[model samples]
Target: MDTQTLIYIFVGGTFALYIGIALWSRAASTKEFYVAGGGVHPVVNGMATAADWMSAASFISMAGLIAFSGYDASVYLMGWTGGYVLLALLLAPYLRKFGQFTVPDFIGTRYYSKTARVVAVICLIFISFTYIAGQMRGVGIVFSRFLDVDITLGVIIGMGIVFIYAVLGGMKGITYTQVAQYCVLIFAYMVPAFFLSFMITGTPIPQIGLGSQVNDGSGMFVLQRLDAVLTDLGFQAYTSGSKSMIDVFCITLALMVGTAGLPHVIVRFFTVPKASDARKSAGWALVFIALLYTTAPAVGAFAMLNFVDDVNETQYSEVDDWFTKWEGYGLTAFQDKNGDGVMQYRPGDAFEGAPDYSGETGPSGERALANTPNPESENEVYVDKDIMVLANPEIANLPPWVIALMAAGGLAAALSTAAGLLLVISSSVSHDLLKSTFAPGISPKQELLAARLAATAAIIVAGYLGIYPPGWVAQVVAFAFGLAAASLFPAIFMGIFSKSMNKEGAIAGMVSGLVFTFVYIAYFKLVAPAANSADNWLLGISPEGIGVIGMVINFAIAIAVSRFTASPPVEIRRLVDSIRVPRGAGDAQGH
Candidate 1:
């Protein structure tokens, strides 16, 4: 079969599987909807958590970021993985033991104030919505390329699929569906890695392939060869980083804390039966997540090598089929700067802005650009980094089935995380905002209905954001992580660790951290893009790394404010101590 038919088979099959799982596991009660009835096995929940945690950023964009940014992008790998460790050791078990359906629920009960819960809900909404936008955009990219549809129509189709499963199955359906998704996505990711690795380095293991000498007669190791190629093209060496040390540390710290604080991931621990299971599931999730995390660097190196080798200095008439297909989507473009009828891929912008296609073709049959070319730059290409992974198989001439599998995998990764984020948003609205605070007397059935309606609304909003994303997939996700780090991590950490922390302090700290981070990011990202460089940044911290400072501000302000405020009530302090003690620990100690 041809590539298109194969994509139809693979993508259609996966969608069917996801919807069938949703129908089979339709949630019946509020508990089922929110936490999958809290009966999931640790292993199963771990797989589900991996799928939920690995969003479009992880599956579709992280490797692409690594491919382009090289050593500088290592922060994503370190921060996200380290953050999981923080969650597992410091937060997950304790939160699961707290027995709250949502993060807002824990804050509300722990602080003994409705205001604290509402604050957390607001933070959760902001973080989840920002994060979901990237996932929905990933869905659109996959559908646009493989299914040959407009990105807006693709997002609508994705929204419909997620709405059915998310509104029907709730956490119960999403959890099971994610397990299936994990299988599909991991297999899809690894197959190409194995193929490319063996083809380039004669090694099946991507990790080993990354370090092995290339099969080419020159016999240079992968990184060495990549460094040589990039530097020759007037780009920074692939193995060396250009970011300042402080910025790297801050971005990594922010991502770590942000991962721990993400409400969607934290809520996954609640689906388990007990604190022990939460810990167990977290361990299993690390193993599952590592399968992709470890492979990403190798895949990125191979992709960059392949891309440059295939496209750089190639004749426009002889460009690969993948190049033309992607260019048609306006993701890949070229300008004949020297009128050489050849495409040169180099560093820096090719045009003043994003490619503005005028619905016309050039003499060489390439898409004609309306945007003015950058007069000072020699670069003649603009390839969206997001397309690197999806185009990898096509660029390498992998089998039709492999390319099709990539399409399915991308959708699975995007949809799984989107479903998780939507659930978090819906639960915050229905469970925390309505049933807990606004309508404490609401019936369980009514709350369930409300949750479904809330999920439907969230999906619609998420779809809209996906159609018009604020930034690249990984960049947008990084901002969400920063927001989570600033607003939620400190609150949750202090809630469990410090008995003296009061509602007044918690509320104040969250608001201040959130506002500071949001304003800093907006100032550079939206308000003043021209001044976003290192020289203009505060303490030389870019917007992506500023969240670490916001987190510190939260910690400092919460501690300072708590010193003058009343201590938490006696029972609340006792409750804090109780959660700190592991479940059944007293029994194990013969208490």
Candidate 2:
């Protein structure tokens, strides 16, 4: 079968399985819709959490980012994986013991204030939306390239698939679908890496192959060879650090803590049968995630080597079939400076060559092009990072079947996370907003309808955002982590650890954190955009790292405000005590 047909079959099969599961496990009660009745097995919940946590960013953009950025991109690898450790050790079990349907429910009851609950809901929405935007973009890129559809159409189709499972099954539907997604995505990611590793180093395992000696006549290791070649071409060493120590520390910390704080991820723990199960589930989730995480660096290194070898040294217009082919999809660009047919991919420092069209020239100037206008533009460099994962099979000359698997994997990653995030938004709106605050006397049937309505509305909004994403998938994803770190993490942490934390304190902390992080992001990314070649970011820190600072401010303000407020009532104190115990799970999510 052709690649397109294979892709359609694989993607179609996966969606069919998800829809079938959703239909079979259709939620019948508010509890089932919101928390899957807290009845899923620990291992299954763990797999679901892995799918929830590892979005399209992890499956598609992460390895690609690492591929080009060299050692500077280690932040993603360490930060994202390390967050699961934090979740398992510090948060998941206790939150499950607290037994709430949503994060806002925990905050409202824990702080004994409805206002605190509303604030948490707002933060959850912001984080979830930021996250969903990236997934939408990812789905678009995958469809445009593999399925031969326009990106807009790809996004609409993706939305249709997600809406079917998410609206039909709620948490129950999403959880089962996510488990299936985890398998498809992880297998898709590993197959190419293993094949490429075996081809290059005679080792089937990529992690081991990365550290093994290269078979390319050179006696040096793969890492050493990659470093040597890239440096000779003016790129940084593959294994050595390029970013400042402080920037690395901040970005890594932000992602680590931010991962633990993400509502979509944390909510998965609520579906497990017991508090102990939540703790065990987190451990399994980390194991599933680490399978891909450990292999990612190897994939990154291999893809980088393939990229430099394929495009940089070769003539752009006269290069291999792949170059012209991808250009058809708008990913590779070529411009002939000085009207020369040969494309030069080198450092921009040389004045003799044409103006640098590389993104490094900053955003102010138009892209540099050679004398030719249409057929032979001046400076053409086209390699979208999103293509890195999907194109890896082709780069390595793997079997067509392997390539088909990757297409399925990309769709799985996008759809699984979309379902998880949609569930969080739906539950927060229907269960927390409508039933809890707006109408406490709401019936289970009414609440279920409300949840379905909220889910439908959220799906529409998600579709809109996916159809018209504002930024690159990876960078937009970073904003979601930032918002989670600054606003939700601190508030939830304080609400649990500090009994005296009041409504004013919680609101103040959340507002301060949210506003500070948002303004900092807007300042760097959109507002008052920088003018220099060097990014004029504060302290060389990107907006993604500003969350650590914002989180600190949230913690400080909440602590100060709590000291001045009256202590919690005896009943509230008793409630806090009850939540800390696994046996009190029923009372934790009080009726």
Candidate 1 lDDT trough over 10 residues, lowest sum: 356-365
Give one digit per residue, the lDDT tens place, for model 2 in 75-102.
9888898878987888888888888899
Expressed as tens digits, the lDDT of each residue in 225-247 for candidate 1 is: 99999999999999899899999
Q: Candidates' lDDT values, in order? A: 0.90, 0.79
Cα RMSD for candidates in order: 3.7, 4.3
The parts of candidate 1 lying over 4 Å away from their true place are 355-370, 470-476, 584-591
Q: Give TM-scores for every candidate, taking all chains together and pairing residue i with residue i.
A: 0.96, 0.92
For candidate 1, report its TM-score: 0.96
lDDT agreement of model 1 with the native: 0.90
